[model samples]
Target: MTRHARSERLLLCDELDRLGPDRPTLCEGWQTRDLAAHLLVRENRPDLSVGRFVPFLGGHLDREQRRIANGDYAAVVDRVRRGAPAWNPMSNAKVDEITNLIEFFVHHEDVRRAQAGWAPRELAPQLEGKLWSALRRSARLMFRKAPTGIVLIADGRGRYAAKLPDAHGTVVLRAPVGELVLYAYGRKGVARVGFEGDADDIAALQGAELGIS
Candidate 1:
């Protein structure tokens, strides 16, 4: 089977090259160059990648990211396009496919949807199914801190609920699985999802911090 994640990674790298380092992205405070550096660090630097979850290790990761970002922009993009080194787990096809499919897809949208005149890309049903499968394993964690119950409806597919133990009010978000994944990853303002619930609940959920680190 073709590795969709690999294709998305290359495509995103090309986009970074096309847009240049100064272009904005949906990732807070990250321009294209910063995003490229982040991808490189994520795939290559195991130590720094762990810092994504370990708070104390983050300062070093941030400094390294800055150093990478300050290097020649074209070279950075080329490195991202070339992907992780052979010894890195991410360089393994199976590992990259399972781990990076949703990652690259989301980051690709982060770049695409953050710019002017942006629109949703039409995705294949197979790709959508892959994304939904990944979301099933991850959605609850992403929305674990949500203020209210979250009912995610993958339009024409299925639903997944992320609810607090004593949660009362609920918010229903209906959208294609791809868009729902985006919302689950904290892209609320840009994700094309329909909200159904009490206005207060909706507001609170929308305003709350969502997504993994």
Candidate 2:
């Protein structure tokens, strides 16, 4: 898991370098520089990472992010490439494996799938299995605000339920686990996932707010 996470991080950094700082990414209103800074802050700045969940500190967090992002673009990417600093929890191998595997993979896809002419890369079967495991555990939280219950059907791998509270109905989304991860992360338009169920339920799930930042 650590190996996968580290590889994804390095690849993301390479993409940022290739695309340059001003290039647009899938993250709303954020350019490559902003995304790079976000990755850095996520791993290194515990103080601001808390603001991701606590609304009151968001302003301060945004301010600090902008300040960090103002550094040389290459330098910022280099920092991300170098991995989390020694004092950071993510610097611990086990913690990084548990936490950042999905984080980096999703963010990596955010940059890749956002660009024109982009295509999904083939992933190793083991990596896909790992992603599926993570999705099963996180599906509920990621889709907590979903308007309908979601049953994620990974082609040839079986199914897992996303138990959203107050769900009006259920929708089944079928795709490879890799694609399902993208859809679960709210990338419905680009994830290549297919839907089945009552039209209303499908529509509700498709349009609902899904995934965490």
Best by lDDT: 1
The reply for model 1, stretches above 4 Å from the true place, is: 164-167
Screening candidate 2 with a backbone cut-off below 3 angstroms (N, C-alpha, C), the clashing residue pairs are none
Q: Tell me each candidate's TM-score.
A: 0.93, 0.94
Score residue 29 of candidate 1 by CA lDDT.
98
Model 1, C-alpha of 150: deviation from truth (Å): 1.7
What is candidate 2's CA lDDT for residue 10? 91
Per-residue C-alpha lDDT of model 2 across residues 1-213, encoded as one tens digit per residue: 337778888999999999998888888889999999999888788899899889999999999999888888899899999999998878887777778888899889889988899988888887888789889989988888888877889977899988743566778889989899888888777899888888888877777888875
